[model samples]
Target: MFCPKCKSEYIEGYTHCKKCDVDLVDELPEEPDEYEDAPSIDPVKIRYAPNAIDAEMAMDLLRQNNIPCFSKHSESGGYMSIYMGFSVYGEDIYVDRNNAQAALDVLNDWDIVQGALGEDPDELEEPDSPEAPDEPDESYDNAPSYTRRRTAARVFAVYFAASIILASLFGALIMLLDILLD
Candidate 1:
């Protein structure tokens, strides 16, 4: 006897495969080759998310619509997430080229539905280009990057300070308990 699921051969008396929990058959069907009849899956980027949460949400949406998708974190994103709580560089979501259009459609539909529910679609639309200033503004040029760097530094500082304070408190508590017990 043979188990179709696990492809395990058994004695004639054995009626099922214990591991696969499938009924045994007299003969097993021929297994197809790994690449046989399989469509070539070339991943195409569908969306760029600012963080892991957005990337996960997009991936989940695609999966619900039966589209297979995956995420690629930027080099900095992966490392930054380990140090920080989340990535700052963001992630790129990809889907098979064959399903790219369908995946986009699904995402677009989701966006429209979400907009209808509460969000303003017009506010969601990004401006084509910023209005040019008559005179160059040095402060404006560095504003965004400066703000991001300052914010990140502040966050790191706060985390480091909090950890140190907590550790000190914990150590003090432990010493107090030891003295009391002694």
Candidate 2:
């Protein structure tokens, strides 16, 4: 047979080009299905629907109030779908079926719901306490005040000056003694 690309004579029944190394036979394969379906799974139930920060705060408050609670998706690997292609689930709080109502009551009583919702609840009003007016005492006004001692720099300078004076005095005494002995 003759190679169509190079025009070179090849032996009969040759499957590839001898010069260009091109496959004489077609090498295309069948296309795969793109719309393959996946098996369906069951949806999870929500025991509590606290928002992300509120849920975490509720969980901590529940634990502090002695009601055992945990995040939902963290316990069961199930996520909550909020919108189309947008889902949030990890931070939602959850408790056992028995303690769910009690947890809600504790959160309500502590004003945590309003705090988590970014609003001040009616129960958060400050209590008025009766006390004497705050004023400065007059006894300490005439008392002698103590000041901080000198820093290391000033002490070092004084010591350095004293040492120089002492050294000069000793040197002058030694020179007088040498002159008298001479």
Candidate 3:
């Protein structure tokens, strides 16, 4: 058997995917039948992902949140559909017409969270921009590096100057004490 979600092969007694927790099926069902038990309303495209994998992820998120949805890949999905993936040019994710807005909201929230986590969609493609500076993702003060360096230098100079003056005063006191002793 094969899991319709993660496509992990299972021996005879397995009824569900151990990783995805979804029921096992001999094969991934085609797009139209995805909403077989959903209400009789038409399905509408709610999103277009760059590949079938992302499209399936969106479909899974929607269905997991109780929105009936499915995905249609522009290219042949083949056996890879059972693997929760496949790609050509792109794929369209659809939801029940009445659940379109709800599905959009859920997907939008996911996008927002990803953005906040700094997972730029382009970064996923290019790994890291060659021109981009190496920096931590966390935000801090916008002051320039030179400014901080200058501030630290100034503080050290002030401390050095104070130490020199203090040393001179101590030296003068020692000389005066020696004179009194003599």
Candidate 4:
């Protein structure tokens, strides 16, 4: 079955979600009496106490373990808004009341493993140290600089004069060609 939160798949008999820590069982107490003499106990719904992700993960785990599980959202919107906005309010996972405790135990085991690891799986790694500041180059700063305004103007003038001369030469050649043709 796929994890409702992370969408990760699990095999049958899986108790806890490997990717997310969520209980896959229902843990509510059984009804006090089937007969009229005893007061009836309300069925316990499997719910994620904290986040929708957790609830979805728990449902996925339950499905993998061959337990059918479903999400009960008070609001009709998607899971994110239901849990994130507190639209669902109380429990996030609703399982058969009978399976609640077993699911919780599975989740607890996963939590223990996470605690032993001493770090969150989702946490980003920090750099070992801040980057060193770039050093200023004194040699370049001390280098001599030249103004190119005069040089550029001189180059432009030379190019203009050459173009004029070339144009005149071309015109002369064309005139000669016309005379010869005539």
Candidate 2: where are CA atoms >4 Å away?
A: 1-50, 74-91, 112-182
> What lDDT does the true structure give each of the candidates?
0.76, 0.52, 0.66, 0.53
Ranked by lDDT from best down, the candidates are 1, 3, 4, 2
After the best TM-score superposition of candidate 4, give how far the Cα of residue 18 lies from its true spot, in angstroms: 53
What tens-digit string does per-residue lDDT give for candidate 2 at 31-133?
A: 4775556533332222344235655666677788897766654322242233212223234455565665676577556675566677666535221111223
TM-score of each: 0.53, 0.28, 0.40, 0.32
**Clash totals in order:** 0, 0, 0, 15
lDDT of model 3 at residue 161?
A: 86
- Judged by TM-score, which candidate is best? 1
Tens digit per residue, CA lDDT, model 3, 1-182? 88877657898988878699888887666657666786576867777676656777778888799997777764444333443344333666777777777877788788877777988855332222222443533423576543443353455557878999999999999999999999
Query: What is the lDDT for 150 in model 4?
Result: 31
Task: Name the TM-score of candidate 3.
Answer: 0.40
Residue 8 displacement (Å), model 3: 36
Residues 22-117, candidate 4: write the lDDT tens digits. Answer: 644433334466576864433445443444676666667777776655666533334435333543332345545566566555555665676678
In candidate 4, stretches whose alpha carbon ends up further than 4 angstroms from where it belongs are 1-43, 74-91, 119-182
State each model's C-alpha RMSD to the native.
Answer: 7.6, 24.8, 21.9, 28.4
RMSD of 3: 21.9
41 in model 2: Cα distance from truth in Å? 24
